[model samples]
Target chain A: MIAFISSFISRVMNTLFKGRKNIKLGLYGPPNGGKTTLANRIAKDWLGEEMGTVSAIPHETREIKIKEQVTIKSGKKELTFNLVDTPGIATKIDYEDFIKHGLSERESKKRAKEATKGVIDAIKWLDNVDAVIVVLDGTKDPFSQVNLTIIGNLAARNTPVLIVCNKVDLKKVKIKKVESAFPQYPVVGISAKFGTRIDEFYEALFTVFR
Target chain B: MLTLEFVPYHEIANLSSIGRIRKLLNIAKQNKIVLLEGRLKKEEEIELIKTTMEEINEDFKGIELAVIYPTKNDSGIFTKMKTNFVDMIAGNRLGLTIIGPASIVKAIKKDPTKIQLYTQELKKKARKKK
Candidate 1:
């Protein structure tokens, strides 16, 4: 009788203590949607370092980048998770597009090829991540194929998602459009570049992951 | 010869993710390779891994999945022609992934020159035992 009671108590304690630690939080979105910018912001706020470089050109992050041992606290709640910043997901990747941006024929084609490989690497990383943040450009329409594909994939895994409507520092950004498009998930608007409304993001992160 | 059925991405795209994955698993269990055009939906891929892991048994081992992409290069007209031709027919040819029973892929080698994916037949003993 005493052994049975002890086992029950131990199991309960394990469940409670296993609250949240070493979580893998992934940043996923289309090209130039401020994903890396947000990753930098999060890392700068916590770890005092940048995750990866960002560029106006699409798919600048042509690989999966990880920042480990990040711990964030909001009021009484705290989250410790590895931040995984992935390359943008695109439906059509054309080398010609890169050439149009004044890159050399050789350079553009090379970037396009690397970017294409990066998407597959990012998608493969999906299985291991604990949760995902689907970052979107608030100025653009939220109903693009790449955006829908990302959400659909997240939905399929039933991964807890926090939709980030980024680039709100721009005057054209419409947070409502993003919210309406993905009504099921919680949407938080922030200018990751300018670090606006970042505290709310931290609070929401605690809420969503809690 | 690789004994596998081609599941057109458009056909499988319409099914619920679970249904699509279940359908893919059925093909894998039949001891045949699955040449799927395009890529599986993100969720479908994730669920496919989960289901594949759960269904491991004596008859089947694990899955060996591969994506085939044309060698990408920047300088030559030949490279441009090949890249454009593949894109016109296969959409994003880079997105194509091949999934098959691991029993066959274990012995074959990646030649990088000849056949990109060398699909061999499963062992006779494993099939006969079942």
Candidate 2:
């Protein structure tokens, strides 16, 4: 009787464990769309720390950065995700471009090569991501090669997407335009730098990403 | 208060990425500068550019677009030079990207050199001089 009871209890424990799902949430976007900044913001809010460095140069983050077991709570409901912050995706990576960003000839070439590889790595990771948060620069035109590719890949894979319009603090912000650009996805406009409208972003995060 | 043409404000949250590009092209076809708030995903941007190129012939030669971001650093003269007009206009993944008429873009670029760099930095030699 004790052996039978133990087996029954084991089955019950398995069922309980299966009910709690941990998602792999991804951050994807073009170079310098503030993916790291937004990643840092979310990490800071929930994990009490930052994940990666932010820089003025493009492709500053050329590695797959992850923060495991990040659990966010909204009242009684709580969700946990393994945050995966990937490198920015781009169609082109010219060493000359990095030179324009003040890197030396050797450094620019090295960075460009790494960035290209990073783009490939980021694409390969799409299959593993449960959902994605696309971070975009608020003041820029939303229609571009990089932005379209990321959204298209996500749609093709049937992964949920949350588009974050970062840098609303800028003077020329047109969040409505971004809202219009990707009418299908939930677009949250926040100054990730200053944490403006971040609460709304978090609330939207729960509703949309969940 | 800004209305997004046919897509109702609330309903926009349901339009697919393709639908948004369609709407964007329609607006751009009218010769209006479509200032999209956020940077686009790579594929969406690619399709937009491809479809845009295909549609260009008589009425529209191209479209002019730019991406703007808030000042991150107090950029020094050298740093500004690094991302100078030639560099930023050409290399920025996001920046003041203009894809419209060459004539208009030319007029826009007629006096780019006059624009001031974000912030100034003391020259290394000047520091030693002082």
Candidate 3:
């Protein structure tokens, strides 16, 4: 009876003292490629946050948008995943519109001049991430300049990249060709717009995170 | 010389026959030199190409099966094409040339009319500048 009681106490102590592992994941891709869509999906279903804005416009997310302290349970382990959603990378448009969305015109114009700086800021944030989800448009060629640049940068950083082929529900989207082109990387296909294969996406997230 | 460009489809799920053809059409529109290279001779090579093409559609232009090195698989063609593609995409003149069987090369060489027409049109557009 004493041994049983001691074991119970030890288990309770372990649970109390064990710190939750916090993993930081970045969702990045070219403008209009559904980064926000995927981020919002994960935030809503797994992170328990309301869905953020989803739009067809490019550069919908102009700054580093973050949803912090999301708790996830796997088996007997509890983990915390801090999901960071970044603005789409646009060569032309800087954070002017993004700043204007929340600020006055003078401030928006001031930030616009620093648009290139915003991209640099986003790249710097990559160093802090544990893994990256590089989203690609399902209806366009996967070899676009922007997409390749993003992947190349991620690879250079030695960051594990999970290529998410978004908007797969569209009739014009193709998965096989993308798999063939990037044979070395882990690729997942999902329609972020409709949330299909979302559970599978989460499974992939857990696999890479673990 | 016959130039080939492999354009991977937009979506990972869209790596079907139809998706590949659509992507090819789009690439053809942007550049007149691009052609769809033939399939691999070996069944396994074909399968591997197909699988890889589906995942990394943007990375592959087409698979070239070289007759001189029949035993030597041409999977490296994708990486080479990717480099050339990047150069061209950056507004450079980097072109893609695929090495394949003699017969395939001869067949492509025989069709100069399409390339000639494209070049002629480009010259015509250039002449307008002068």
Chain A TM-score relative to the true structure, per candidate: 0.89, 0.88, 0.76
- What lDDT tens digits, residue by residue, belong to model 1 across residues B1-130? 4687787778776777788778877887787878887776556564565466456544465466544445343347888798888878866324555677766654222222223555544477557779
> TM per model?
0.60, 0.58, 0.53
Give one digit per residue, the lDDT tens place, for model 3 in B38-115: 322222222332332232222222222211111111247776686556645632122222222221222222111122
Query: Could you say which candidate leads in TM-score?
Result: 1
Give the clash count for each candidate.
0, 32, 33
lDDT of 3 by residue, A147-189 (tens): 5446656656666667898898998888866665455566789
Using DockQ, rank the candidates from best to worst. Answer: 1, 2, 3
lDDT of each: 0.74, 0.66, 0.54
| Candidate 1 deviation (Cα RMSD) | 18.4
Deviation in Å, model 1, residue B25 alpha carbon: 21
Candidate 3 wrongly placed segments (more than 4 Å) = A1-20, A74-79, A94-117, B1-130
Candidate 3 chain B, poorest ten consecutive residues by summed lDDT: B109-118
Candidate 1 vs candidate 2: the TM-score winner is 1
Q: Is candidate 2 or 3 superior in TM-score?
A: 2
DockQ of each: 0.06, 0.06, 0.03
Regions of candidate 2 where Cα sits further than 4 Å from its true position: A1-20, B1-130
lDDT of 2 by residue, A1-210 (tens): 434533443344345335557678899988898889988998999999999999999989998999999988889866678999999876445565578888899998678667766776787788788778899998876765357557867877767778999899998888887776666677889988899999888877666655
